[model samples]
Target: MDLTGTQRAGATPTWYEDALAWACRPVHHTTDISPLRAHAQAVGHTDGYRPHPPHRTRRHP
Candidate 1:
């Protein structure tokens, strides 16, 4: 990932330019929850959701 020439002369490699373009491309999101739940189940997350433990507060004398 040497970008000395690109940094100095404002020249970029084709692959680097293409990757930047692809990374900046817009992505659409799906509103369906069924597929998401199915994927979660496949990954063995059938225990539903759990919350983290509460933090303890310090007391002042």
Candidate 2:
């Protein structure tokens, strides 16, 4: 957690945990509400969102 410590200075950075010797669990992201927030900032399509997800935008037609 502390990058400023002396331990990291002389040695290569290692994984924070050992894979073979330990168990792991997923750390849940608290929120991903950027889309709603962005849409609100763009004022409900009156100003428009400039970039959309790539697959939504184009076709060979």
Best by lDDT: 1
| Model 1 clashing residue pairs (backbone) | none
Each prediction's total of clashing residue pairs, residues at least 3 apart in sequence or on different chains, is 0, 0
Write one digit per residue (lDDT tens) for candidate 1, span 1-61.
5668657477544765455445444334523222122223456554333332333356678
Tens digit of lDDT per residue, candidate 2, span 1-61? 5656666675454543242112222223323322212234554453332232223324677
Candidate of highest TM-score? 1
CA-lDDT, candidates in order: 0.42, 0.34
User: Which window of 10 residues has the lowest lDDT sum in candidate 2?
Assistant: 19-28
Report the Cα lDDT for candidate 1: 0.42
User: TM-score of every model?
Assistant: 0.26, 0.17
Q: Once model 2 is optimally superposed onto the true structure by TM-score, how far is the C-alpha of residue 56 displaced, in angstroms?
A: 48
